[model samples]
Target: MTASWTVSQMPDCTDKTVLITGANSGLGFEATKAFASNGATVIMACRSTERGRRAAIEIRDSIADTGATLNVRQCDLASLESIDAFTTGVERDYDRIDILCNNAGVMAIPRQETEDGFEKQLGVNHLGHFALTGKLLDLLLENDSPSRIVTHSSGAHEMGEIDFDDLHRERSYGKWEAYGQSKLANLLFAYELQRRLEAANVTDTLSVACHPGYAATNLQYRGPEEAGSRLRLGLMKAINAIVGQSAAKGSLPLLYAATARDVQGGDYYGPDGVGNMRGGPEQQSSSEASYDRQAAAKLWERSEELTGTTFTFVLD
Candidate 1:
């Protein structure tokens, strides 16, 4: 896991198609920029079309090669309808998908519901990507080349415990707890998907999970800004400046998981330095709870029920 890897070491991505959620900003933007720079047609699936297009334009200008295409499209992970439309467009236009980065997520925001009446963090971070991956499963499996589905997790997963009885946090909800649950679900889903893919004897699509450690990005500020707590926001900014790595550095684990040939299915990667706060991407262990088979199975079923999205693998 520690072979001194970086995005620049990524092999040529000619003819590859990479779809990234939240691609207009932060870590997603870094992912998009790298993939496009390396010749992959990067689809910027963002919630905001205007911002997505603007980012595409900026990235287009930054890259020297004109063959790297950027498609700006709207895909709101908070809304199922938006996700469906986004997938429909991809299916209509693209024949194969080389990589799908489930990178969009919400952090520790106040208790809320998505368009489908699920917890804000769980719905957007886990359920929405869960559904999108399922909807596009066939396209990914059909690809002749190796493909990957990289789910973004966090170190907070160590503190997370799935409460199935109140998964939606209908009875009680804490901001940090909810966020932890969602991030934990990310790993659970990633590992479980890999298991299923292998069991079905599918070799082309690999599902992996990774954490950013501690990165300073706009994501860190959204929660505080939404709560209108300038004090907390200021404190977060100060801490990030002192400790957080740049968004590009934070996105390394994601890119590594997505493109690295050494990466294996079901592998969980993160920073190797102290506290796993910030460092190079490396294979690392996640929380013990993240590896629970029974919980992952139950959560998978629950996710299918909640999202009405069931994965039909291409093992045949």
Candidate 2:
């Protein structure tokens, strides 16, 4: 019988460098805090320096240890320029990134495009991470020990359909639809990356995906706020109170994916409860669409075209 997985089982990560995006709050913050508590050198990458600094301070206080090191870097996923600069600084400072968690994202919202003119949700949630991961691939492979690229997708992917003809929703847009598309794209990118990495005979790098499974966080409010739907927001709040798990509870899957000793590449994890939306972490399968290799490759090609970021690592 499989035993329950818990954060208490997280392996010691002393001196390991773990970088988490959107670490300013919610699940990201919880993940960062847990990593630090377990002795990992944490990089809290956020779009806002003010918020990042504040978050780092809070984690430091919580861990209350002189050995816990937290670095805050400014990276705006909406702008490739910002991502480039941020990676440049990271490469200059750190020789290798043991764990790179693509955890930051934008949820459903008004039809707004990013600085690069892609839909807001797609740009920040998918393309931006695509660019960052491409830039950091070398650093990940450079490490002598095993490395991990953990992508944060969502359960909403079940409702997602990749409309290649309208990835940016240029033809039309619905808030949840856009969010679902991006979330689906996240899984596609993650699984495809793992496949490519394995095909290259590359060892030491594992690409994993995870979802929070109905956790309550600020991410949920983005859509309702953008659409000015008070009733929706109130309903969401009530549902969260009634059924949604805490942010820390929701973060279990991500933390488990990041730190588990037995985790394998391409593994997808989330809540084990009903609908896979509320419970402890467990390895689970994503939607059937997420397994479409042809669609995944197609999405990869489009991502390269749109973001101008290509995975250049040799698959030899």
Candidate 3:
């Protein structure tokens, strides 16, 4: 039988606390709404405090009957300093974190460096979350049941090949290539984190990866102006009109990874439609490189070293 999953199949998140990065818009926003509506305390972590607060208010207005609360916090994923501040604040206020959804990302933007002097894509999409997750590992591990970490990857990761020498594209830069590298890093992080957790016998913490497929999100507009010319943007809109799934639908795979009882560590979730792009949530596979155990291990080591954050749980 084919594996099947949908938002409706998810268990109630009542009394749970989910912290979602970039929860102000797109799939992140929809996921926040879904979790909060199910009675979870939803923390909306956005780069913009204004937008985050507005999103929180919108969720409250829409789900008044659920009696769920939304908390807004500022976190610019491109800045390590900002990430530190955000995590410190969260730790001070929240006793435990039930779920952490690393869903915020940038794609197809011009070559630029983050405040920390790393490539913007790699910094924001992968390293930032890496640092954040490392900092928050204590709270995540404190839970009695499995607390989940869901990294948002992309199907484009199939084309990614990491270049350790030029990870920041100091020699040459291509927007899509950088984006792909970041996404691939996300999958690698998820898989490797699971390995570490298992080796440490921390079965109560699960790490999974997910993709939203081709949903019509603001990420599509990250290209150059000419790249998003009227004709191309119009064509994209036309395609979205015909086949684009709702953001809520796009978020289902993440919800499954975060809450489904049967989901296992390192499992990947995505849409079940053609090319895994436009249907409900289902267990999915990734490129062979994404599953390379050796690479995952090396990447994990490099990530810890580069970010200067070490996990207390050491893999045997």
The prediction achieving the highest lDDT against the true structure is 1
lDDT of 3 at 288: 93
TM-score of every model versus the real structure: 0.98, 0.97, 0.94
Instruction: Provide the lowest-lDDT 10-residue window in model 2.
Output: 1-10
So what's the TM-score on candidate 2?
0.97
Among all windows of 10 consecutive residues in model 1, the one with the lowest summed lDDT is 1-10
Model 2 lDDT per residue over 76-144, tens place: 999989999999999999999999999999888889988889898999999999999999898899888
Tens-digit lDDT track of model 3 for 93-127: 99899999999999888888899888999999999
Q: After superposing candidate 2, which stretches have Cα over 4 Å from the reference? A: 1-4
Q: Each candidate: what lDDT?
A: 0.92, 0.91, 0.88
lDDT, residue 289, model 1: 94
Better of 2 and 3 by TM-score: 2
lDDT of 2 at 189: 96
lDDT at residue 223 of model 3 (Cα atoms): 61
- Minimal lDDT window, size 10, model 3: 1-10
